[model samples]
Target chain A: MKEEKNIHTNSEVLVKVEGLSKKFCKDLKTSLWYGVKDLTANVFGNKNVRQLRDKEFWAVKDINFELRRGECLGLIGHNGAGKSTLLKILNGLINPDEGKVTIRGRVGALIELGAGFNPILSGRENIYNNGAVLGFSKKEIDEKVEAIIDFSEIREFIDMPVQNYSSGMKVRLGFAVAAQMEPDVLIIDEVLAVGDIGFAMKSFNAISQILKTSAVIFVSHSMPFISRICDNIILMDKGKMLLKTNDVGFGVQSYFDNQKLLGALNFGEENIILNNVKIHSENPRLEGIIEYGKKSIFEINIDSLNDYPKVKVSILVYNMAQINVALFESRYISIKSIKGQKFIFDFGDSFLSISNYFITVRFDDLDNKKALVVSNYVNYRSFQVTGAERLVFAPLYLKEKI
Target chain B: MPLETRIYQKENHLKLGHLFKASFKDMLSSRFLAKQLAVRDIKAQYRQSFFGILWAFITPMFTALVWVFLSRSGTVTLTETGAPYPVFAFTGTLIWSIITESINAPTASTKSAKGIMSKINFPKEALVLSGVYKLLFNTCIKTLLLLFFVFFYGVGFHVSQLFFPLAILMAILFGTTIGLFLTPIGMLYNDVGKIISVGLSFLMYVTPVVYVIPKEGLMKTIMELNPLTPLILTSRDLILGNPPAFLNYFLILFAVSALLFSVALVFYRISIPILVERSNA
Candidate 1:
């Protein structure tokens, strides 16, 4: 294997894409009709596939990139941003309309785990079936069967019918086989987001090891994973490349900055309406920003038509990934005959990393079991913590004197 | 040791000269995967069933028995078929069933593997080869029962029986040729599959299955004109040790089907990616 790697030098370009594009129809009926027409054109050797017909739009447009051996390219974009379409074309599952994609050596895609597995068959039997589909000969699979079983950590259930196995077990087995495939060009989608944390970490480590040899194309929404593995990054949106740079951090930062903010959402009983949410800071320059070690006060205004005996208010803050980071709850407060009421909480010098965060306010019963009214100020009242960007493994930067 | 490079472009896909070479290479490479898939399907098909593989034999036998009962009860009158009527009906039904299975194989196999195709990039030819593998497995079982029926009816074995395998291969090839041509379209529109079964039941009547060819009439002319007639008659004649009346037609059909089968292979190669994109929807 080492000698083989030396043969295909690290600088050898394994994948090249030039002006690649594909058009897809939105309507099913029209798509089928176009399929018939495209097939006819293909049969007749017609070269008119580049033009988009009625009801068709470009799914991937004029995308170009090159990847060489031992280089990993990260593809970051929001959903429906043509990242998946680009990966499909690179994997050779579909054809491009305008340009060409030249890929050398064997290519493997981790698009979906356990894709070819038959549930009725035993896990052991499916390993062989899946291996064969991955282009492994019988003897080759025979040699790696034990290693795959060990890697999956389901040796005891190897002979058990896969239908009876848990979903996590199937994913483990699938990842095990894929990890062992030493393809020259590896296309990794978001398949790492499966199984439990332990298995996911194991697969991630295995993939990072494989990255040393193969020219990899990785697509994921997790910025940390992308920054950790990708030597370079390409940010895409609306079927076009937004940024192509060696600075993984800048690319990821741009991706976060490009996320569209959500509007204010206040939904519940019509009688209790959320009026406004405002933040007050001591420094006018940091009015909307929350610094790592600064005091900020958040005020919530509500108009209640009917008086409530007792209500509890809870404020939850979530990061850009929608992960809950902070929660502040107020004890029971009686509100009677108050048309306009206010609740205020002071956030004092909390150490939060520089990123965008949203707040969700919920008014629940005194017991905190039932919600009376809820208001989500996702992007409408979102706040950003400003600081010099630094590379850290954890989501939050917690500082303590040492 | 240079790596094997594959280039994908719309125009490159239309290169008819390279399509056959690539399809054949993929077919050869996918043979092992095809066998594995076929074995998995065959095992899973009968794994949990009560009767297991007995159903494969029971199905054709039951159909053959129904026709035999109809013939014996005077519900349908039939002309003399040289050998015993039960043997004649059973063999005819067996051959007809093989043909139908082959016709349905490509689409059926591709549909079953739709889950994998959209997710993984593999040699698409594997699905077609796997379908053929499954068809051959089922055919083997049916042929065993067919031989038993032929001998039990006392249509004593003859040297001409040596040609049975070749005759059967020709039948499968003919059926598969038609099937391969329809698979690309069939994967896109299920109407092709539904229409095929309906058309096949009607077509069986005109192909001399479960009945002898008419002695002299318009029915005979239709039977003679049917492409399947030569395949069925030649296979039955070879197995039953009768001088094949349609040997020349069978040979000609074989040559034509072989040529068409190659064309269909290339067409499938060209049309599959487009069909796959639609089916993924």
Candidate 2:
């Protein structure tokens, strides 16, 4: 089945990482001492190698993947899931403790915006400096300088010191330089969220232009953006790979499901508590797929020890990346009597896209200031927007008159 | 697509020749970047200062003036330097400053770029090369000042003076060799930079910078033992039309400097990444 699904007949692998791992020490003094010891061991003919020592742990381990030309790989993980560490290792900013990474062709990275820019230098000068740091020749920068400045939209401020440029301008210029370099492999780490929406669109268009020829590895918390750009996805957790698949929808669903199992939600200490939460459709037999433009109901069961004066219930719908997509709240109809009551949220028509989503149930006071019970259930249920046109740029399908 | 890059843990067995060749090529490819960095530093070094580039010559010139005043006041007895006291002291201090500045340049440059180094991957040799460029610029300014001092003191020019630039170059190479060796350590610990600053000032007195080396004494023996003593003496001899003294010692030291610099480059290539990672961690 896997062989049959292999689509690219002439694609070549641009980046191959095999069993790569990196260990980091928690304590500064111990880390420095470990560095010295490692250096000495390298200098000497000592072959003894241990994976971990005191105060040290693997930040990334046994990560294996191959990126091919014209492919965009999405790296989805929660914070501290070793995504940044993996990017650093691939970019050659840091060394790995074990395994090997073989890369073909030049690698351009927007790892951090304006990372190598000298604040005292003018924007024009920093363009040259940044290009050089990215391994561009002076003649190459000279040829592309005008286009870079034009793309950044900071032509007027090009002669001003970079310290004077705003943060948005800095990112614009940074992305321009990296994009113009035409690297064979491009690695972007959540740098697209910078600038206003217009600039973000422009930058994404530039990325798409580059995607035609170069392999890309991008990490973003925006699921919509990921689905729009990525052809393959890898889900990571606590320095380990959990899933790697080409189906963007399934990969996003798996990521949310894993987050639900691992993330510990902080519940409020109050008289009322959530007993259970379930999603139901019109057809009781149907499971795991909610067809678009159909009715769906969220049933939340509450268990209370005593009656309360005023109580409100709310259900928040979140995308896999934990971004809130919709909210269902019982604000107008208050629960004066807090007996074990079931709150049913009915949506006339569901417009959610084909992806995983989270349901967070919360019982709050009358003013919504105090939470009686807070339960964050990630990937509580997943639905597919079947028989509808796929919306890759956004999860919500709003009816418009345009 | 013609090149394949593989990264892994460094091996225990050192390939000295391969390391040298690779590092040399990397440094050569990064020359334009190094030039940009150097240009940034040179422009920023004096941008906000009122004295601007004058500060480069003022400090050493003031030191020379103090020594000349003391010598004329007869408060401190001094051995006869072959040239006029002011010219001798000025030239000596100027060369000594070049040594000290070159030694400090690499460490300072690398430290300042620590933020960028940890965040970005580039040919780090560019930083060292940029520091060298700054040293060359400063040395050129100081050389012009030295010419002024020679004319002001009415010291006649000699054909041998043509080799003065070579002497200065040697001093810079010697200092930069030591500096490159210390850069990794200096970047790791703040104390290394502080100690160098204080130690270089104290070391000046032990070298024959202002006065001639005594014929026989503890200070003379210490001065003779100092490696910089021969370098400074040879540079001064070359500029003053005297057959350079300690030519054999200078030759030996030059060879040692080259070897140490090569070794330091290897060590630097290996250690800098670790140091940068540690700092970020």
Candidate 3:
């Protein structure tokens, strides 16, 4: 694993954004009027006032970052948190209202796949069109057309119009073109979530191949992806940076903590509300960091409205995608639990992937065949599992003897 | 290759010359993309239509036929137009269509690419250049029709007729310049496009497209004052082997169009991103 340190101090900076901010109007009419006014003001030599006007709010504010070569910066945030806006500004699709961004290379952006494709044009023709839109010349496209078709694996349908191609095929072709461009700076936003798992893997391989040389900025809500690819992560909330860290696990944890603090509503009935949830290492003195190969305990406290018998508490550990990694049932603990109790689930070893996991505690009444309460069902409490290995995708680690 | 680029907020001072040079370089480098876009538009235009490219000829021919009917039926009396009625009307409306097309091309091109522009980052100049390409394609088709009418009217070719292409180029320059200036405004408001459409149709009447200008009347004064009148008149004179009239006015307009186009390019480079940003918002 590469040492997690500030690479900016030693490497050549490829992208530098300073004091960047953008404001957007809520209403279309007002936006248009403001555009005209700004244009007129600019033409007449009026200094651009950086303050917000009526009905305008900052979409991104006071962002500063420097990305060096061979380092990928992951931008994570909730929807409408200005991630896309920042990407747009970096791609030169829009200008910031208050700062400057200097990019020192050709930027190949897969912001939206197949953005300029003409539905009436054949796939072969659209390769030229879409490639040109990405700054490739006609002769260059002519030289690389075969490789693009081969990479997309859609050579059989290259002569057919794009309108006839299925959605997955379109994504394949789009990503193939973008991946082959060999840009010095790559800005990709949630495009890897497209296509089937096979194509996604192929795209990931392509990205990693590019990461060997280019400086990349990736925006995705997938924690596993960010943990896998990004050396530095910026956790953003409401258009402001909350934390920037070199530790991927810590960054993902900070993002989840911020999300929890933002009051993401819990869905379970208040009959058994979660009183407290805490994670600690096996050693009582050391807390917070969960290291791999060490026993850890998850303590969940629930407050019950009334005393109830035959209550079973189940602790479920889920990966970032909410897929269950492991489930621990109270039956294994040999505890006769009732309402209003603290349940401690202990694992022998933390063999889970080096990623974020969410714990969901479910309180069920066995006699009545009903769920009495669930703890943080809507927004589960997430914890990070850090390990020595940097590349781990699946939830569980297993060893097999040949 | 590492191509350095910068993004910044609106500042009080801008190096206009540097900005213009950079924008021109960007446009020139993206010429292949512009050509590809033009090819895409031209191919898609007639793909689903029953009439296809024939509509291009049918529109002006149909317009000329209607005006000829009105003249023959004595519904609208026209002044002496030395050439045969069909030939004169055809040539007039053909030139008029070319000008209107040139004026409409920029807005239409930019508007059609609005979806992609908001999502992808590319040189917006490519759209303008592609619009010019489409205009050229249409002009080629119209020029062929004009030659057919010229011979049909017994107006044989003369050495002066060699300058007809120059006149057509001037008309395009004039219309495209005005269109470029209107593009940003048009992208912001749908009403601009509608207004331009309505205004161009009405403007043709005062430009002497199908009728001679009145000798002495308020209409003549307005016709004489129209900047387009000199353009259409000089072009028509050249095509008919007559000494080009209003050459000075046309030359002045030509120079103004060039200057306006440069300004328009700068305006487009600055405003288009803002417009796209707002639209995305």
Chain A superposition TM-score, candidate 3 = 0.71
Which candidate achieves the best lDDT against the true structure?
1
Candidates 1 and 2, the one with greater DockQ: 1
Off by over 4 Å in 1: A1-3, A262-345, A349-402
RMSD of each: 5.2, 6.9, 7.3
Task: Kindly list the per-residue Cα lDDT of model 1 for residues A1-402, writing each as its tens digit.
Answer: 445676666898999999999888899998988888888888876676467788989888888889999999999887888998898888877888889999998898888887788989999999999999888999989999999999999999999999998989999999998888888999999988679999989999999888888999999876657877898889998888888988776776667656654334455655556676665456645555766555556677778776777776666766645566776566666655566688666655555577766567677654356655633333334677776645544324222111
> Candidate 2 has what TM-score?
0.83
- In the range B1-281, model 1's lDDT, one tens digit per residue, is 77899898877434665778889999999898999999999999999899999987887778889999999999999988888888888778878887898888888888888878877888888988888888788778888888888888898889998888887788788888899899988888889999998999889889898888989999999999898998888888888888999999989999999999889999887887788788873
lDDT at B170, model 2? 88
Q: What TM-score does chain A of model 1 get? A: 0.75
lDDT of each: 0.81, 0.77, 0.78
Sort the predicted structures by TM-score, highest score first.
1, 2, 3
Candidate 3 residue runs with Cα over 4 Å from true position: A1-10, A261-356, A359-380, A383-402, B1-3
i-RMS, every candidate? 1.2, 2.2, 1.8
Ranking by lDDT: 1, 3, 2
Give the range of the ten consecutive residues with the poorest summed lDDT in model 2 chain B. B1-10
- In terms of TM-score, the best-performing candidate is 1
State the weakest 10-residue window (summed lDDT) of model 3 chain A: A1-10
lDDT of 2 by residue, B143-236 (tens): 7877888878777798888988888888988998899888877777778899999999899899998888999989999998899898889888
